[model samples]
Target: MLSGQSFMMFVVLLCTCAFAFLNGFRDASNSIAVAVRNRALTPTYAVLVAAFFTFVGTMASTSFGVYLVSAVELGVPDGIPGLALLLSGLLAGGAWGLFCWWRGLPISSTHALIAALAGASGASALLGNDGVHDAWRMLAGGVLLPLLFTPLFAFAASWVLVIPVTWLVRHSTASDVNGVSRAGQAVAACAVALGNGLQDGQRTGAMLTLALVTAGAAQPGAIMLGPQLLGAGCLAAGVLFGGWRIAHTLAYRLVNIDPLRGMVAQTVSAAMLFFGAMLIHLPISTTQAVTSSIVGAGTNQRFESVTWQQVNKVLRNWLATPLVCALLGGILYLAMHPLVS
Candidate 1:
């Protein structure tokens, strides 16, 4: 928007937009691990298989509720500028995500983006009360809540469920239960695939919905079918690309995952994500959901096995995200305002 031809703007969009794709690759491990690690599917072929299914599911879905995500909340003011808002916040958030990827750290794109949106919106809010209440409530209720809860729910579900299931596995260890576990793998795999569709795919859909509005290709306030389908397709394609570097960190390092743990985590993440998505047509963070699930699963293995250090790191990022984004948004909005005006 700068001088109506800032190459930097386009460049930033290209780089920042990839966060959605990276998000899927990074989180795919939650679903693929049980199948791949357990030899239910070879890594290469398994991801390919997951990729194909994920893509299909996303493309097939409609975008009826896309509005929930295209807009973020923070008690922002009206004069902040939408172009500046989208550009600066996304750049900061996207850069944050890429920075973590470079360090081989698995962080949440949701946290980064939400922080960016909140920061930028709050900066604008200082100007007037145009979009304040709508945004902040959303940040707290829609985006932040799900991301925070994914792990909490995952942790609690696994905490209560894993012990009993583990005991059962031990009990059934005698009579060729391996065969039964193997048999159960197919069904579990399907559930994981559905989880991917509802979980990761929705975030992509939301962003795409916003992009279309920003570009004047669509209307605002409500999400539509086209953007949703497009977003889902893009996300599924991302999963096929594979994010092995960090996926291994999650699946292997998080805990000694077996089929039951993997499936349960996937199922929990999917349940929460899908419900959130359908509730407001907003794309919630699968990264948060699945990460929480893994963390929860880790606790089920014993709190000692749970990586509190990593959890602390994640929490720190979550806490700092908004402040950093707010500062970035304020600075960039001021700088870009005159040019756009």
Candidate 2:
């Protein structure tokens, strides 16, 4: 016998977990694409390593959860309406993720989620006396800016980092360089998985927490272990099971990645993502970061070596996904508002 609020909250929590699972499934390539492409690790082992590190990262910290909760609150005030907004956003994001995964496109689930949330918040505001302008402003300032800039930073950073690494290793024997690169690839893969788990897991955790608070099932400050574990576990399973399609696109279609290039690209992307998520408190897209870093790393060999067509497709998807999800989110929120309100 659950109360109406409690039932709705439970639904929202479930949706949040589902969204996280999709995030893991779609972005698993972000962590292991280079390693797989370079044959540094077998696909099975690479996924296992990614899953293990993802779980570890999720359990390691709650800081990202806190930041995401605060950001959502800033855009959509907490209550029943806020819960509705969150649910709408999660649905929109998840739908877009599934579509992209099916199409073997490595779009950013992070951008989808952020854009959906913004759209839902705008719709929620519309139902009330407050206009949608403030919500849009908050989203633009807090989430959109970081999402837009972090990939560029990762691209530039990876390009710069690869040049020096290339010079340093130029004199080494091919065998020696290969050995070092294989080892580095493993390490960088772990870091990327860990960073993804922390950033994405925390987002799901924050959504669950918000739902609980809205339902009066928990206080604002109370952190629940159950939701955290559920989110992390689901994400790990998603990584294990549903990553192959996007993995192929990323590993084979983007660029011909050698062990050295893979190592450099993964290392740069992981470092940038960790810095953005932990220090800058931004929910940057690991997918976009890694993709851009791959481009940067490929540029070291020659611009012609990179598949510009595939890169163009990815870039187009990245720009379109958010806008499409935002529109869908707004429509869903508007439709659900009367019932929820």
Candidate 3:
């Protein structure tokens, strides 16, 4: 029979894998929506391409994984309470992702998880598990700041890019332009999928490692290859399943996008994801970056034709996601603590 701590660790690990699947299910559209919209790739092929690249990216590097583990581990207590906190956080994030996916609303799984972790940490602190200082510190520098800046930066950058891209291709024939744009969209879509894999794969890995360490099954800074590969496989499976509800919303409801515009939006979002992961060392939401970029690029040509109602709805959901996940995390942790203890 498993010890209480060992059993709790196993539960947390299972929850972390489920959370990763939700992340990929909801965020897969960020990469394939535009490409599919322009007929650059059929829906089936798109998912396959996305799944392959996502797996590759997840296994690509552990830099972000290490950073995330360090950032989150320091915040919670060790042993059973810590395991409960992580489980609560995972459930909170996964719940929000499912709700949003059902409603076809684009949301940031990364932001939701971060908010949920912080809230669980806060709740644990309230019960005198420990203080909230470390959790607060991690959220401030990692999630909140990126939440504020990434959307605006992605939008502005994509909007401006349309101008120059249009200018360069102005003289080209329509067929020629479409062909080039289609090709570009295909490449950019793969790049975005790769980035998403890198961002989210590491997050799930970190959570799993945290659970093991808290349970005394592993040591700090000891990341095992088996867990990383398992997380990546789960993520890739989710990508293959795809989130067509969200995909339709992004492809048609949010904006009127041509091949050129789709290419521009995806390219900008990919750059931001890479820059965040490698250079600035922050997690950027694939949903926020890609959705905002599409809107920005759409508005460049005919602002009136863009779907304001849909834009407003998506924005409202984006704002609500973190708050909802945080509350849920706190509530779940409080509710589960008594039983676990």
Relative to the true structure, how large is the alpha-carbon lDDT of every model?
0.60, 0.79, 0.85
lDDT of 2 by residue, 1-341 (tens): 97667777878888988888888888788898888878788889988999999888877657553355443354345567767877888899899989988889988776787788778876766666332236566466545686688768877887788888989998999999999999999999999999888777776666677677766667766446877788789888888875788888888888876788889989988887688677877776788888888888877775466888988998888878868988889999999887876
Worst 10-residue stretch by lDDT in candidate 1? 71-80
Best by TM-score: 3
Model 3 — TM-score against the truth?
0.96
* Top candidate when judged by lDDT against the true structure: 3
Cα error, candidate 1, residue 311 (Å): 3.4
Alpha-carbon runs more than 4 Å astray in model 2: 63-66, 75-79, 129-134
Worst 10 residues of 2 by lDDT: 65-74
Residue 133 of candidate 1: its Cα lDDT? Answer: 48
Taking all chains together, each candidate's TM-score versus the true structure is: 0.79, 0.92, 0.96
Give the Cα-based TM-score of candidate 2 against the true structure: 0.92
Candidate 1: misplaced stretches above 4 Å?
Answer: 1-17, 60-67, 71-80, 127-133, 182-190, 221-225, 279-284, 302-304
Candidate 1 vs 2: which has more TM-score: 2
User: Sorted on TM-score, highest at the top, how do the candidates line up?
Assistant: 3, 2, 1
